[model samples]
Target: MVSVALAKPLDPCESPAPFSLLVPVYRGDSAHRVRRAIDSNTHEQTRPPAQVVIVRDGPVPQEITDELDRISAASAVPVVRVELEHNAGLTNALNTGLLWCSHDVVARADADDISYPDRFERQLPLIEAGADLVGASMHEIGDDETTPLALRQAPVGRSEIARVAKRRNPISHPSVVFRRSAVEAVGGYEHVPMAEDYWLWARMLHAGADVRNVSEPLVGYRVSAGSYERRGGPRVFLAEMALQWKLRRLGYVGFIQWATNVIVRGGYRFVPLKARETAYRFMVGHRNS
Candidate 1:
């Protein structure tokens, strides 16, 4: 029997995970946000990543390019930039970036997210201990990092993650540090539209990967004004439906479960905007200080 070594309750010791930071940046994203995200990784970090892999997901603004160059030059940690000719979307861009990650573990970061200084140090031991996919909780920052709107917690341990994932996305995408080989073994991220991370987790959980999450909030996820609108609408609903179908096809869910999932999620999306907003607030848990 292959017993997985799970992460112990964290102590003060700084242990960096053997990993590369995977960040995909494009034109539409905030260049300043990208700089701050990388800056967060560079300071107060007890264990910095082996390399920060930046995937240029197409032609970004000249300002973003300059910021990347500036950040790279200033970083004490190694930085690898992979330039793609055209925009391949997040899933494709991530898949492309992973190929260049030399380390076994890969920490994910979005261009707009603000990672806490000790984030990777907290997760490194978990990945080192045998977690194939490890994520941490997050604060959904509204106006600023100091003014967080909600505490979006994730399930702890593999079984908990598996259970929670069956219902909804249990891992905060940006808070995750996962094994590159394990991802590759499961065929990596799919080309799903809005459900890319969810789809990947479903597949990984189904494949029996040892997924876990630390209890601490390691990143502050920025929420835009149009977040709810962008997350709703017919297009998003159809994408969720497609994800369910794919999940069912992967044998992760039975036909009945798939149908139920579609109905449940679809209904949730269609609820009155205010009610949906309330539920989102509820799901995200308590407000952050």
Candidate 2:
């Protein structure tokens, strides 16, 4: 969905709008996946990111170190690695990378997720059209895209995004390209665990950013049926509840919205894995099934 605000003709820019991609990695198991993710961005796109910043969350295994080394050694575009002394989480890693990035626009790539070659190309226009933040739908794949799970959908347009923001995240975290100044204006990313993206989106929206989503799937989001189960637990629920109250304090959530978020999301955390699978399909987004 094009932002209705940008429905008018797209005036060509004097020069290309350059952007950069950022990926955060922790360990060896993710190295191969990270390579594929980077390949999708650089190998065939008409307009690839100017830089790919991979932040080493901590001391990764030698295999991961080797893989990053080899890729950086051969890439045509800059594949810069920022190594951390110890394991800081995703939020910190991203925050670190953001400070190192050069462009005003930044796209995030999960080390384990795959991007379509044109993902960056497709997102630049929305940002150029005054979107501070833009994301798109993704094919939620477990093993492969064939017979996959769901197409994770995000709300489109500013008003719809604000309405959905009161209850849940209206943007896909990994599949986002946001204006650096807009994000920094809202305090960059907080150190919120499990729900950093949710917290950041709410805060950014409250700070009056124009957020929108394209309707098409541009990313292959890796989603095992059991992922919802593993990614949810007592700690995650606690973090989520904390986030609810945080949003409430930020005026992005009301008392009822906060309570409902705590109850509904916390309850979902306790369901069996099979039931969690169904909840993942139902709650995550619109279903083509």
Best by lDDT: 1
How many steric clashes between backbone atoms does each model show? Answer: 0, 0
Q: Which consecutive 10 residues in model 2 have the weakest lDDT in total?
A: 1-10
The residue pairs found clashing in candidate 2 are none
Local accuracy of candidate 2 as per-residue lDDT tens digits, 69-163: 98899998887889999887888999999998988889988887787777877888888877888899888776664554668887777788888
The sequence of per-residue lDDT tens digits that candidate 1 reaches over residues 9-118 is 33457554457889999989888888888888765566778789999999988999999999889888889999999998999899999999998788899888888888
C-alpha lDDT of residue 182 in model 1: 78
Model 2 residue runs over 4 Å out of place are 1-11, 145-147, 286-289
Candidate 1: deviation at residue 121, Å? 1.4
Question: How high is the lDDT of residue 119 in model 1?
Answer: 91
Q: State each model's CA lDDT, in order.
A: 0.81, 0.80
In model 1, the runs with Cα more than 4 Å from the true position are 1-17, 284-289
Name the TM-score of candidate 1: 0.91
